[model samples]
Target: MKILTTPDIPIATLFQNMREVYATCNVDVSWASEEVLNLPALNIVDVGTCILGSTTAEQNQLFTHRNSAGSNDIVIYFVEATDPPFNGCASHPLGMPGAVVVRTATQWTFAHEQGHVLGLNHVNDNDRLMTGNGTANITNPPPDLVASECNTMQASPITVNV
Candidate 1:
């Protein structure tokens, strides 16, 4: 995995939160490296509502840093902000698997966007991690991931056996 963040944002806590979230389902989260990008133009990205299966020019530019080793590694980008009402986005250009998370996003936002990349969709329940109501709106302290969702995540091509 790879993480790209602006120089001002600290992602240590976010990474810890993400590891904890995925660990609930027995999925280990590890990264080879993290890069602190200094691109001011990309510091604040305009994702245009983060519609699934589509991406903006800024998103395309940011995702271009994805690892090209053909290992299906995931890249997480931390930006200053996205369009209003969205804290993170999982939409990427074709053949690119990555997500963009804002600096102010909830702890679960990283995991939630990753769930989308792993083929999990929004459920209406607030107690679940995949809730479309927003991670900040989750009523439960640690959101739940049902068995089916876990299965979906493990079955994604990006997942591999240890």
Candidate 2:
């Protein structure tokens, strides 16, 4: 469970929040750039400039990034506000085990996507972080998200491949 954050306009607090969550999972995360390669067994998180609507070019870039991994790799893209109103989505290379795209909204978006990165899916549990519609119940979450997810992950003790 390694996360590589790309340079984006998100607030430092947001990144801090993400770091705190990953730390609990023992997930290793680092800041990387688009030019980076050789990241075989890691999760790549990128921040893309606002590109409204779903177009071929946008889809292509996303597909390229999502498919860059060999067998066990993941990519997450963070895009700014969009028009039609989409909170977030998970996409795969062809259509399975893909990257997650989160629409920057409140504080919980990062963690929600990180949930996907950790191989966790959305949960109906209102207090869980994977709750949709921003009801993630994690406002200013504790220092460790895995510990937070313990109730959900059944104390699986995830190790973030940072």
Candidate 3:
């Protein structure tokens, strides 16, 4: 994790929530390391609505800070904010598995964006983790991840057996 800005919710709280969510699906997730960045120029990134098909120069620059991360490792960048209407983004430069999260994100936002990094797409269900409407709209507490989504996540190169 690379924190460009402090999030409204504590990172520990968010990670706890994520661990609980993924635990239900038998996928153990944990952060290997963290760093606090002082790049004021890249703090507030313009993601242009976070379309998964492309990336912005600002995002490209921001993501370059991944230090010594293996190709299969996923780097999570916590920024002050994305353009607007997006709390987090899963799009990355080709072959780089990464995601950018905003300071205002909900507890589940980190998990949702990481889900995308693991090849999961948005689903219409509000009770699920992959909801297209946003994490705030999730109707269920500790949003559910169905079997198929679990398979996709586990199959990703970023996932490894213990």
Worst 10 residues of 2 by lDDT: 45-54
lDDT of 1 at 37: 65
lDDT of 3 by residue, 13-91 (tens): 9889989999987999867889999999988888876878699998888888888677777898999877754899999
Residue 23 deviation, candidate 1, in Å? 2.1
Per-residue lDDT tens digits for candidate 1, residues 1-162, read 343444233467667777887888888877666766666787677788777798999888888776443447777788777765478889887778888887778878888998898889999999999999989999986789999998898899998879
Model 2 regions lying over 4 Å from their true place: 1-11, 34-61, 65-73, 81-84, 94-103, 133-140, 143-162
Model 1 pairs whose backbones collide: none
Q: Candidates ranked by TM-score, best first?
A: 3, 1, 2
Task: List lDDT for all candidates, in order.
Answer: 0.78, 0.45, 0.88
Model 2 global lDDT (CA atoms, 0 to 1) = 0.45
**Per-residue lDDT of model 2, residues 11-88, tens digit only:** 455557666666565654444323333332222233233222223334344446543443444454555432244444
Work out the TM-score per prediction: 0.87, 0.52, 0.95
Considering lDDT, where higher is better, how would the candidates rank from best to worst? 3, 1, 2
Write down the worst ten-residue block by lDDT for model 3: 78-87
TM-score of 3: 0.95
